[model samples]
Target: MATLLHIDSSVFPGEASSTRSVADAFRATWEERHPQGTVIYRDLAAHPVPHITADAWSAGYAAAAERTPAQSAAFALRVELMEELERADAVLIGAPMYNFSIPSTLKAWLDNVLLLGRTAGETPSVEGTPTVVVASRGGSYTPGTPREGYEFVQNYLEAVLGGTMGLDVDFIVPELTMAGRNPALSALVPLYEASRERAFGEAVGRAKELAERFAA
Candidate 1:
């Protein structure tokens, strides 16, 4: 059976997070498509991976037999994370914008899985693997928007997931997510609703498209 690596990095739980909810929708569709598929789920907010450390960093370059005890301990986690990414047929990530960028927990997960010679090199092990990202944000960051220049989440992920890691990535963005609750964004509520609906549609369509592609 195919395997999916599903990751969510929202600090908020369940449907409270736009990215998580949209990602959930996509994952639900994907699971329906492959009823017996294996899914490796990681809730980064609740169980954040460790930040890359010197021991872990050094261990990647050292031969297994030469690794020190400290290096072995730290590198074990990175190995597990990397193995998950390598084994997945597809990857789904909920990377909501936080301060114009991705959450620290997500960053940590990336760091753990991104070893230069393995997952981030010229020919990454997971190269061409399909990956979907739900990139929800509080405000609009599309081109021509007031905060367009401030956009970092997509740009950063594109560079990391696509550029460095060589994964085939598609993004489903739900913008202006704070419009419902924030008084300052009240006027944009309609647009936010539209965006949210569009995101869900895209998630479902994309999930089906990718799932079918894999089945063929």
Candidate 2:
């Protein structure tokens, strides 16, 4: 059976956040499709990874394959997270576009996982697996639209996750377009509700499909 890691970085849970909802839905469907598969979830909100400090950076860049006692202790935390990523056959990330970008917690996790000679190296590995990013935002950021200026989040993520890491990436962004107008907020309540449901359902479907194809 294959192993899957689900990473959720949303601060909010039940309401006012679409990231968690989509992630939960996807997990449920994935479990149903692969009954024997192993699924591990890491909630960044409950246990946030510490940001890279000066000492951590210094140790990481050092040539010591065998680190000092202090460096060994510091690098332990990062190694734990990277091990989880390496063990998984596939990964699912649920992030909300906070202030037109990904949350700092998720960014920190990325920094820890994408280490030199670990996740990537001088020669890229041909065996690198696939990753799916389920993104949620309050505004629209699709291309060729007036609000497309907000599209920096998706582009930046794709470049880092796909281009740099050499992983196949699939993204799903369901926009609640009518929520901006104060007067329309109330009128568009039903639309926002329906959009969330649809987006979550679609994410679940796509995640299951990918899991079956790759994990099989």
Model 1: per-residue Cα lDDT over 1-216, one tens digit each: 789999999999988999989999999999999998999999999999999999999999999999999999999999999999999999999999999999999999998999998999898999999999999999999999988999999999999999999999999999999999999999999999999999999999999998998775
Off by over 4 Å in 2: 63-66, 121-127, 177-194
Number of the top lDDT candidate = 1
lDDT of each: 0.95, 0.76
Residue 207's lDDT in candidate 1: 90
Where is model 1 more than 4 Å wrong at Cα? none
Q: Ten consecutive residues with minimal summed lDDT in candidate 2?
A: 118-127
| Candidate 2 pairs with clashing backbones | none
Minimum summed lDDT over a 10-residue window in model 1 is located at: 207-216
TM-score of each: 0.98, 0.86
